[model samples]
Target: MKLIKKNTERGEEKKKRPKKLKRIKNANPSVVLDRHGNIIRRVDGTEHGDEKRGGQFLAALFEKLIPPGTKAGNKKQKTEMRKKPKRKAESEYNEAVPYDFPGDIIRSIKNTAGDFAGIIGGKSPSAGKAGEEKRGGIRDAAPIRKLSAIRRKFMSLSKAMRRIVIALSALFVALVSVCALNIWASGFRETWKAREASDAEKAALESILDEAFADERSEKLRPLPYRTTPAKLDVRAGAAVLVDTANGCVLYEKNADRLIPPASLTKLFVMYIVFKEVEAGKITMDDIVPLPELSWAVNLPRDASLMHLGQGQTVTLRELMAGLAVASGNDAARAVAYYISGTQEDFVARMNAECRALGLKKTYFVEPSGYDENNITTARELAEFARIYVTHFPQSIEEFHSLKSLDYPLQKNLPSWQKNYGDTLAIHHSNTNPLLGKLDGVDGLKTGFIYESGYNLALTASRNGQRFLSITLQGQGKGTKQGNEGRIHDGTELMEWAFSTFADYEPGKDTSLVFPVPSLASKGNDGKFVNLVPAWKNKITVPHLFGSTAKDSADAVKVVVDVPPYLYGGVKLGAQYGSVKYKLGEITLETVPLVADRSLESAGIAGRFFGTLAKGSLEKNR
Candidate 1:
């Protein structure tokens, strides 16, 4: 409580108390100790311990890296490290990291950092006015940022060529693939060009035969009237051909390509067109005739054959067809033409169109009536037409061409004005076909003879199911009787020869003869096999006797089925898979294409790719 003279009493106690230590200004924050634990740098009133130095890694590294020997005997270096630094160098070196390390690393790459970015440009912060020391440490005049020699060398080679190498490799692969595809395409192009050339050649050959056109001053196609030929029978006709209807095989041919005037045989094609129209529902045999003045027998030449048609006659198309077929009447032909197409010119145009459509190159018709010689055809071409005619209308033989005779102008054929004049008006015409009753199984076709063209006949006869079409043209003689006898004799010989030589056979039709093709069958077919059949009827006409009198059995013929070993998926329906060959000893008689029975889809990308590998392995194993 009594506080009198406090300052005087404190002064008296201070004289007896101990003295306190004082902290110095701008002194070292740490003490540098040598290995013996002796302090090199001391600071007043501070206790230094190893604990604080434990966290200062740089200071410890510097102490180990900087030995006493690198410090020169120069008094200036000693003074610079100990004294307080004024610029950035002093604060940077305050840590244990050496400031000269950058210069030591970059000295081999660059001698100096002259005019560097605001620092280390040929001078140091701690250097004296004389010059900077060039020792291999951070003291050299270097830029603020420096890199070693290895790092600078790496920067110069920065552009990598890896992407370029990869691109070139890809281009090389594509070029190789394109070259392979081009080679394959070239082969296909060559094959296509070859086919085109073959077709062009065939068309050219046909043009030569078609040169004997109507109304032209050309010579008749005459190749030896009596040729010692393959049929072993001398034919008196200029051109003749015997073709088996079963398989279209030519049994005998002699100048069959020669063109000649068809004469009355042109009616055969006229009847063919009429039959086609009937089949197409365009006309019927019961159609009434159009009795124009051009159709009356009065307008026709007196020598022209007729059914004695008069004006105001009530003839039907059926009667006209019979008259044209059996009587070979020119009047009936014009009348029938007018009945169907309004004009003979239009009907002739239709005939020509049908001829071209049927691929008969040498057969040309200027008029439907066979009384004119301008109607021309070749034996081979007529035979081809006869084949199609029979194939389309086999019944035409019984209905029209095979009739023995046609009697017309009866009560039914006469008009109402002449109904009571039946017997006086009636006319009888016998069949003009010379082979009708003379030859057995000779139903009909037609016979033609004109002054300019000799006798011509398109004859067909079927003894068994096998049939042969015989075309005999230009049977030359002095008169119509001689010409008629020649053609009839030639036709009868050819028909008999063909029937006895070749037999019609349909191969691979028997269910027991089904051919198994290994294809996509394993993948989709339940039976694990695809059944391949002939693409066509596969009917072959071959020698059943070969000069023998007896007919042979089917077992005597040899059938060879040729097919691929295996088939993969993606096969199309009706695609040709192989072939079936009909053989006789060493000779191959006929070959028919065997086609795939069904279509199959692709399995997948992976399945296709691996399937190819498996196929290769299969071949190798086989």
Candidate 2:
């Protein structure tokens, strides 16, 4: 090879020759042009046009041909298209993304990327030549297979949901059953609690009735028997009443408000109203009532009793009440009514109004004295009235009923005997009240007999702490005095039976029992250990119908614990304890709480050792 020389920057001679062209085997190329329609640059430099760069070079040529005014901006541009080499197997395996991506995603990525590229280049796809068509268009793979796989996964998830629903339902049912059992057991546990009892207290109250009913001279409840006159004691039908002084219960009753005759019992209600009036301060015992024109008479009728009220005579309200209750004076009734009401009819209206206000549902008064064709009251109604009157106004009996007579002088020396007119014989009247002196605890109420209603009696009495009222209506008796024998007999018998046959009972120490708690149903940390307690210590005293005989006596108290249902594992503590059982004459049982159980915590080894050492040290020091 010959040495070459070339001119150098140092002005030294250098040998040189034309430079050989550097051929690029696969080089991408383009053609450029200037204003003269001349190819200023031939980038590929090949006789046969290079497939890759030929289309790009021709596009650039046309861009430069446009005159400056032909386009929006005067500019000449150049373009080059480079072919992307195919990825070989080795390169494909080296990439993190495998060749086989799911078909759907690959197609979407290419389509989106191509659209973005075209917008930036400012050219439509059709502007690229046939050989460069692939560079401009995006390629995508089919996506049908990927869609099928997604559908398969959805079906699998739906199948699992049904099994989960069934499992949850079963769990819910089991939870409810456990709660129900816990509630049931808690109800019964309350009855097992214990109560303290004393023996001496029980015996003290046992004979309370017998001592209360005992007769004493100062007690003043002895009954007085009166002789009855068949001729004068005439009642087509009638009623009567007697009341106990102690608790104000009824002791005897007759047809107390039947319109038969104002034989005598009507005086009781009249006296009651008068006593009430005085107590209310409307009138005083000393207040005087003027005698009416028809008040007094001598030899008026064979059947009539004498009151001897002069037409112009004035008597105190107290004396009139005494004459009415003790003497059963007809004139006294007229006198008191006229003074209180200004007229007899008005006074009777007051009586009727009084009866209605007292809840005496069956009573009606047309007259103050309960005389014939006027006033009517049932035996039961009178007994109730007597009960209320005597109970609320206890002082009236002593003031009115105990009087032997109502004797007051009309003039300074003219003394007249008012005499006992409660019950009458053929020639004289006497008290007709059946329970007057015959029953213990009995006090003042009145008695009557008439043609219309028959014999009746109302009686009330008290024994121990209990009070009873008995009413007998239309007994086997007529108005005749002997006919009233039935009334007296029934009244006495009934009062005796009420006081003697029945007794009140309280729970004894031995008999006090409690309700039982169901073991499974009670609620607590441990259901078996906890119990419900009774809300109250109940006491019941039922009537003992049997007598005091060996057979009649009640058996020893029996306590039974009733469990309604079997307990379950999750039963609640303090559920219903069962009720205690007892007989009428026997004592009742009380319940109490069970004592608390204690639990101890275990100590660690180090703590236990120290505790033992401390104890030993303390003992040595002591």
Candidate 3:
């Protein structure tokens, strides 16, 4: 092949014909571009001579494309061009080129060369420069650099350590997930448990109501006791209360709502239950109750006061009650409870039920005997209970509570053991109540003592026509004997103070019938209003000084009438309708039930039809 050489110094091209080109063995291959810039293979298909001239031809072609004064050919010129400072004019001229054709072509050629170099040399020159740039960027700052160093160190470690780190990360994530699940589960479980507990409580209350209303005859009794708030008083007992039984008025109280242990004062409820049984005709006083094994066991304890009935002995209900009331016999109390309700627990439940029915809050009974400290009540509630007791079973007080003493198994038939220890095992058990005979007109009440409740008493007294009931609990004393004395002393002082400081007052006959409630059925004179009278005629009491007479005190007291906004027509004569409250200033002295003096019949069918029409017309117009 012949080669053409360029004479750049003289700026001329010279063509020289050489000898036939010799092909070199194993020479690198070369390619040529046609006028269209496409590669063309040699027609001879020989690579030997082409390899020697191919590079020189491409260099010469590139030199022809570049403009004059551009330094791009020689390596030393390239170095000098890079070191030279650019002139202002040249820089502006370079920026003035609208198209970046030369730079683009140069970049393309470099990319192509890099690709080929990577294939041949296993790495590109630009790749190393790019990695070095990345290393010098912001990511190479201290924090990131330290993190990268730690990563490198971790990678350098053995496989076991790397696995340990990965496992720990997994375990941490798993623990967080488990804790979250536990919190969610606990919340759901607590909410479900609370819901179940509320449901159970509702069911229990429903069952209690069912049992209480089981007997049809139970309807005959009052469902809820009347309530009254009176002036506060300072009394020297842990708890004290005074109530007017005839009218259900709470006259004076101190810590009356505080729950306290009742001790044997619980016997009052026992007696109340027994009286209910008697009224039901379930058992009579003369009826005999055989001593059960439980009842006989009462005598085994030295601390417990018993009726002294033997193991196989039988006793009349009357005798048992006497023992309960006068001697405060725990055994007698238990016997009465069991006899009436079949079990002491059942009887205690009955007591609590009755308490609830009577609207007594803060009262609970665990056992019938009240020996357990769990038997709890408030002074105000206990006084209310006593009022109901005496009002319903007046004979109980006279028959059993009034007795000064009683001889069980009578003195005539005393056994040799009792005779030998007559002083210690006396047949006569004196009434536990200290005020029975000591205070005039103080008939029958009960006294109680336990380690928990220092001393307690429920006392009733009457002077002339005035009746008063009082309770004193937790009286101060050093011992049981001293406690009993303190209770009696407090009771006496309270009674004396009440009777001396207050007098019973009755409003005049004209004022007694204050409210004339119109009957809904009444229209004409024949169906006139019914006169409502106070249920308690002379039951109102007031504080009085030494010189004050009942008349003067009654004049000072204010009478407030409270009647229903509307009264239905079909009313019975002498039936309680409303209440009359007596007050002195802001202090309420008493409240008495207001009753219908005359019966009012329901309106006839014709009257009712017209009445309904009239009522509707009035309502619509208003």
Assess candidate 3 and give its lDDT. Answer: 0.65
Q: Give the TM-score (vs. native) of candidate 2.
A: 0.41
Clashes of 2: 82
Off by over 4 Å in 2: 1-263, 297-302, 312-314, 402-429, 439-441, 461-467, 475-479, 503-542, 545-622
RMSD of each: 21.2, 24.8, 29.1
Candidate 1 lDDT over 372-425, as tens digits, reads 777788888887788777777888888888899877878877778889887676
Q: lDDT (CA) for every model shown?
A: 0.66, 0.48, 0.65
Candidate 2 C-alpha lDDT tens digits along 317-356: 7767766775566777888898888898888888878877
Per-residue lDDT, model 3, residue 229, is 42
Clashing pairs in 1: 100-137, 100-138, 101-138
Off-target runs (Cα >4 Å) in candidate 3 are 1-234, 297-300, 411-426, 507-525, 528-538, 545-622
Of the candidates numbered 2 and 3, which has the greater TM-score value? 3
- Cα lDDT of model 3 by residue, 1-622, tens digit: 6688899999999999885533222211244445433345543353334333455654554455433454554545545544658645534544553333334333444455554554355443444544312232212233333345345444544588668766766786698876664553333222112211135534543454345333311222121132344544445679998765655555677887788888888988888878888889888998877666677645546787677766545578898889888888888877777788888788899999988887777888898777888899988878888887888888987898899998876533344555544445447789988888889789878887777876889999987767788999888888767777777777877787767666666665335454665455544543435556554343555666324654356457787878764355556655778987777666676676666655557788875664443443333332
